[model samples]
Target: MNKRSLIYSGTLIFLFMVAFLIFTEQKKESPSGVVNISVQEAKGMVEKGDVFVLDVRTPDEFNSSHIKGATLIPVSNASGSNLSSNRLLEARIDEVPKKKILVYCRSGRRSVSASTMLVNAGYSEVYNMAGGINAWIDAGYPVVSSEDKETDGSQN
Candidate 1:
């Protein structure tokens, strides 16, 4: 090949690489718009009432114990598999009022799945609680049982 032709080909290849790298960086910064945050940070946001906290644990687990004011949307059933390939969260996307939503489970595993589901459902700001409710309890936060809540006369 001629020298000029070789130079032209090299320039096109370099431009393609640069474009690809930029696209990858953008994806990393906002992968489907899901962010993983610590429980402490989630608590602060919850205290401020700026985020909608989603509890993805089972109904029984949620009834037995749960963070105050968290919305229950159990991602999985008793079998450890969620409905519709975990698209259950997607179906309830409209229930989330706030632009930013925080999610948690018994541990951190299900929260990650729930977060990913939310992002795919077009939620722009989804935060997964790193250690879930277990971490929150370990951090000395309070959780209320269903019976306690019912008798507290704080029903809304």
Candidate 2:
């Protein structure tokens, strides 16, 4: 190969490597365009009342206790297949408004997948609580049980 051709190839290779590194570094912040937030941050946003809190847990778990005002949208069933989960979310997408959304589960793991599903569905500004409701409760945040809601409704 000629010296000039070798130099040109080397420069292209260097540029490609730089671009790859930059892309990967940004991906580390959030996978599939979903952001991850700490439990404390999630609490602040919830209190501010500008964000929609999504509980991606089972109905039983959600009824047991969950962040006040959170909307229940179970992401999986006993089978827990990705295809079924995606389809379920797609079917119920209308229930979720197109706004800032904070998603959580029992231990934060499931929420990541749920958040990704939301992002894939074109719902922007999605965040997954890093520690889930467990971390939120551990941080001394209060959760409202179904009984609490029932009692409140009974008085009205």
Candidate 3:
């Protein structure tokens, strides 16, 4: 090949490599619109009342224990593999309200899935609680049972 042709090819290859690296680095980061936060950060946000806590766990799990003020929005069924078929959330999307929504589950995996769904649904300011309620409990944060909520409501 001619020297000029070889130089041109090498420059194009170098530019392609640079662009590929940048794209891959960005892919490694979290989804563009969703923010993953630690339990501590989540607690602070919840306390500030600036975030709407959306529990994506099953109804049984949520009734057993959940963050106070969290609205139950199960993204999975008993088998825990129906996240992609999240028709419940889809049908009730309006119930979520437009706000900074903080999503969580038992171990954080499902919350990630739900966060992506919310972002795709055009709900900006979405947050996934890293480690989920498991992390929150391990960090000594308080959780309320469904019974507690019932009693509190009855007394009020």
Candidate 4:
């Protein structure tokens, strides 16, 4: 390749690397104030009335089963890699009193996004369940299903 062309290509590669580094660095701080906790701890906190549970999974998943008393703030298109925005969480954030919010998903993938959103929204005590409901179930915790919950009651 010509000298000028080689230099231009080198510059482009350097710039791309710089941008990639910046993006990754920022991503590390993505959780910022959000905390991660074990499912067992979450259960204790919830039972002790120090934290409120939030289910960020889809409605279908929630309908099947979820932590007893967890508030449903569904987030569409949530996954481990992509933390999409949840209109429900944004619109009803005010309803979730300023307390330790324990967020979980089907298997903990979406909780990362939900917790991040809560922390970014200015909720100081936000937490993500490391393994979501799967961990909770594995810990021998009981979950509430749609058939068991009352119309307005959050728990069975």
> Top model by lDDT, which number?
3
User: Native-vs-model 1 lDDT?
Assistant: 0.76
Residue-by-residue lDDT tens digits, candidate 4, 134-156: 88877778887867652322221
Q: Report lDDT (CA) for all predictions.
A: 0.76, 0.80, 0.81, 0.75
Question: What does candidate 3 score in Cα RMSD to the true structure?
Answer: 8.8
Against the true structure, what is every candidate's RMSD? 9.3, 9.2, 8.8, 11.1
The C-alpha stretches of model 2 lying farther than 4 A from their native spots are 1-28, 78-87, 149-156
The number of clashing residue pairs in model 2 is 0
Sorting all predicted structures by lDDT, with the top scorer first, yields 3, 2, 1, 4
Estimate the TM-score for candidate 4: 0.67
Residue 18 local lDDT, model 2: 100
TM-score: model 2 vs. ground truth: 0.71
Would you give me the overall lDDT of model 3? 0.81
Q: Residue 134: error of model 3 in Å?
A: 0.4
lDDT per residue, candidate 1, 1-156, as tens digits? 999999999999999999999876552323556787887888899899988889887776777778888888877774454456344555666777648898999778888888888888777778888888888888877778776553221221
Total clashes for model 3? 0
Q: lDDT tens string, model 3, 30-71? A: 745778888988999999999999998877677778889999
**Per-model TM-score versus the true fold:** 0.68, 0.71, 0.71, 0.67
